[model samples]
Target: MKLIHAINDLTATHKDLLGLSKQKTEALTNNKLDEFQALLLEEQKLIRQLEKQEKKRQEVVEAWNEEQEYSVDSLTITEILQRLDGEEQKMAEDAAITLTDTITELKRQEQLNKALLEESMKFVQLSMELVNPSIKSMNYGAASSDKLSGRSLFDSKA
Candidate 1:
């Protein structure tokens, strides 16, 4: 359905935007200038994928409309019915396959977007942990040691 296709496209766009925003936010917080640039490039790639899907969807819609408009002009009612039935069946099969493929692709994109979001969140958390002054204070012993050993400040308490 055209409505379904439109909805899917909109959903994909929304997810892509959300993922991109999360990535940008995480990059800023983490002070990872190189990662930030890479994220920007990835966002562009997602935009291009969305555009390509939209174009394919439009083509499907146009083909579907044209198929529906086609008429089988025949002198005999039987011949006309046969032709119409064949055309309808063919169109139905094609539409079904196209719709299924479109939905699958959309679902895959959604999953990818979700994964990207999760990765962004992880990056944000990692950045926060790295930059948080309190964390250093909490591991004061390690910070004080010139060797940068893994021992925590709490090690003495144990």
Candidate 2:
């Protein structure tokens, strides 16, 4: 019973995470840095909560195995599915599928968000380079300007 409950909680939390991931993508795409930062905090909280719930779910499985006089040392998903029966079994199966699908969606969204962020960072760096031209330049020349014409004034090995 507790295991089912934990699975349900995990499923719900994952659903929340999936939603947050979508929101994060939107925030990044729209260049809403404030919203994106806020979502990052929310993401951390959900991830921490999910970790706790996952631990609880594993403990519940161990407890159930003990209750049913089964060896808990080598507990696997197949073994757990066989232990569960009736509606509980169906619910657990559905939750597992939902968990997988939602996780996949989250990953896709995260990748897109990462691409957007990388592009934005590249743009920022480009702008900075343009504004501060010397940031990417190397002047390995003599102190006198008269000696500069034949030497390299830029960042190059030539």
What's the TM-score of every candidate structure? 0.37, 0.80
Best by TM-score: 2
Backbone collision count in every prediction?
0, 0
lDDT of each: 0.60, 0.83
lDDT string for model 1 (49-151, tens) is 8788767766655565466675533223233223445655455445445555655665665576567668778988989987875744575553368664766
Alpha carbon lDDT at 133, candidate 1: 53
Model 2: how far is 48 from its true place, Å? 2.1
Residue pairs in candidate 2 whose N, alpha carbon or C atoms collide under 3 angstroms: none
lDDT of 2 at 84: 84
Whose lDDT is greatest here?
2
Instruction: Give the Å error, residue 148, model 1.
Output: 54
lDDT of 1: 0.60
